[model samples]
Target: MHTSAANELKSESLELLREYYQFPSAELRNRLVQLNLGLVRKEAHHWVNQCTESYEDLLQVGCMGLIRAIERFDIAKGHAFSSFAIPYIRGEIQHYLRDKGSPVRIPRRWQTLQHQATMLTRQLQVQLNRQPTDQEIAAALEISVAEWQEIKLAFRNRAPLSLDAPMHEDDDSSASLADLVPDNRYQSFQLAQEDRIRLQQALVQLEKRTREVLEFVFLYDLTQKETAERLGISAVTVSRRVKSGLKLLKKIMVGSSS
Candidate 1:
């Protein structure tokens, strides 16, 4: 934004905040959120290079924080709204990344423990002439078994594995995470059955003559001449009914879904 536009917006925001402080209506709150949306976008942009989460997702989460800040802000305190609101926006995105295992926001204490655990493992390997078990590690660290387990689990799961990651470590193996996922036949069968039920329901909505014509031609897999003979109608009439009935069924199905 240009300097002049920034000044104008700051001026506008000040007046709106003063008005909102006194009136406290939904309309004023909405306007305040709109005027300050740039704050959310700015905070979200700061996280774009730091994590794998999409910018739009970060922006959406930051907007929630911005809304909370606006609702609780005290204009009487003389604090700059930008300064006050930035923490809320930044904290929300940090929390989202932490929960999503972005690995940057791991607690300082846990990070320290993880480092200690790594060093301790190498020492114990030489002393015992073998890898230390979880129990031995926890005892050596003077922490509970559960705490040691948690630390190990968090460190292991902190980063997402790409779907392109190899499923085998062999030099010539071509398998990947994507290839390991099972696409079973039962799920496909269920989807097909659901579609058949929908088609049957749509068929029931047709007029009696039209329904009979469709059932004979489609369900029985009969030719138009055979369908017409069964229905006692000319082949031309059967063709017309089939076309009109299909168009109406398409419309009815679309309307029902909507």
Candidate 2:
């Protein structure tokens, strides 16, 4: 799916979450969990190669964390759910690994500190208008520079260097570690799950016919002619709708972002 379409789905999930938050229900919670299962799978796979645990075991454990995040997430916090939930999901996997005597254990305190540091780094970058120095991050975390460095070093040591490690292919060409990982449909779906709330709301402002045309062409992945057939309009009309709809969406999205 195109990135925009994937973003649309994510926006829908967020809208559902908002509704679920206002009127808590077992069914809505279950649906929210189902919608976000990809996040669990992504985090679980992240640890799959880092430890000796089976993927299935890690996945089941990760789901528990996802459930906790769904229950605890505050829509009014103005934080992205994925950002808030990743720590929970990762914590669960890490706890499972530690409990089961995984060899690559990093202290829980250090791990928690590392997550705090990451969040602080972003805030500091914006405030400083540049990448924040390690000292600045350390201060924000209320830790000495040496302890912050130790936390960073320990977190690095916990994972094998694979994500961006260099590799050689059969033809002797070099590639990044990410290129070596399988880009399966599941990963594609995960990509689609990234948030794009502005675009989603902008789409909602479109006329119903235009919205339907865009959905059929983008979300449903249909050809312009096929979309026209389904909507009982001429192909030319579908093309016009697609163009005008996108123009309007871009305007709304850009204005909102600014």
Candidate 3:
């Protein structure tokens, strides 16, 4: 169907749904799905581009989520149905990708965590007007620091760097960076779960200022100058504190492992 026709159908369906939403009526439910099927197709297109698979399979999976969303939607919520339905549709597609669409399938649990992490990162990024620290995001989500690290790892797994894409230099004719770069995950860890927990525990033992300095430096990837500016301290102090915190964190991690 044409874009205009799909949009018109969506608008008409939403209007009907807003006025009369009957749970048991097959006709009403069917109409809503038929109209909103376009949404599923649209969202599936996004994944299909990234994924090497037939679009039809993903479209079918996304439609299942759209149907479920229609069944569960509450008109009284006073929210746009499109906004609410997109997540459901996206989640379904991602879940399907994790299961069968991708060669290296991640577990369903990690997939859900990664999805939550992405949404929370966006939310906190907007609220803070800068990238949020893992500590801040963890506090807001009320998840353990280790769990947040796991989410980050899971998110990284989904990110694929193209071998044909240029890396550093702007020159397009240069050799692709993939030849020089090794995609190794086993070297140390992209931050192991054990390390995170030990580090979190060590953080609690540090002085408040020391903990804050480390948070700014590592979690937010702030430089000594930026940390000093934000915390109203000298660069020397931020440097000293970060140095001390790292020493302590390293000791704690080693202790925990032993």
Candidate 4:
């Protein structure tokens, strides 16, 4: 399907899903579910034809993705659930395919480097409360910085393997993390949440008066006149405090993150 047509369909589907989610009558939910199923089948049918996996299996995985998309969607953000859900659905299907196919054996040296990098990254984050710098990563992994850089360069050259490789013939629904790409968008959300938390914490560390001015002006959405009256200050004084408090808070947040 054309991107425009797909987006329009997704938007329409999200609207229907939102209405069903808000009201949550079984009849309405069932109707919407059926509608979504038809849409999933249409998309999945095209994909399944190109792969060895059964169409029914792909449909089942797609349904799981749809259910997840409905549950996680936030209407306040003004994003269509379908747009967010497509990647999730595709990931799940790709996972299924990888689990059912033959695996490519990665070379021992590359596997070791990959494992070391992952472990060092995790250890650095735990100790420093953030992702490690290149030097930190190298030190933690007991490698020279130059060697670490070379390993990273070499790792980038290899193409990633498929996730749909089966563990064994009998296993139908299991896939390894090796089969999946990290969702960079999800990583960005995690970083944003951490930054927001750090900022809020830094705000709490401000002087009581400064914090109060900020809360009154921003959190409570008060006008300068109302804030002045509440705090027994002139409007001019209130505006100055708000500005000073904001500048201080920004400094504090930046300092804490660094």
- Record all residue pairs in model 3 with backbone atoms less than 3 Å apart, i.e. clashing: none
Clash count for each candidate, listed in order shown: 0, 0, 0, 8
Per-residue C-alpha lDDT of model 4 across residues 1-258, encoded as one tens digit per residue: 799986777777767767866776667655655656765776576456446667898899877766655664556546545455554565556556667882423457656976988887777667775546778877877778886775664454223322222222222224221112223554322222233334445555677777776665654445566566567777777766766676677666566556
Question: How high a TM-score does candidate 4 get?
Answer: 0.35
User: Which run of 10 residues does model 3 get worst, by summed lDDT?
Assistant: 164-173
TM-score for candidate 1 = 0.39
Comparing 2 with 4 on TM-score, the higher-scoring candidate is 2
Off by over 4 Å in 4: 1-14, 25-27, 102-258
Clashing pairs in model 4, backbone N/Cα/C closer than 3 A: 97-164, 98-163, 98-164, 98-165, 99-164, 99-165, 99-166, 101-166
TM-score winner? 2
For each candidate, the alpha-carbon lDDT, in order, equals: 0.68, 0.67, 0.63, 0.58
Q: In candidate 2, which residue ranges exceed 4 Å CA deviation? A: 105-258
Instruction: Please report how far candidate 4 places residue 144 from its true position, in Å.
Output: 50
Candidate 1 residue lDDT tens string, 95-173: 6887788745446677898899889988997887655677988898889998887666555434432333331222423
True-structure RMSD for candidate 1: 24.5
- Give candidate 3 misplaced runs (Cα > 4 Å): 1-11, 104-258
After the best TM-score superposition of candidate 2, give how far the Cα of residue 84 lies from its true spot, in angstroms.
0.9
Worst 10 residues of 2 by lDDT: 189-198
lDDT of 2 by residue, 81-184 (tens): 77667667767776677688987655678778888887887788678755566688888999899888766655653643332322211132242322323245
What's the candidate order when arranged by decreasing TM-score?
2, 3, 1, 4
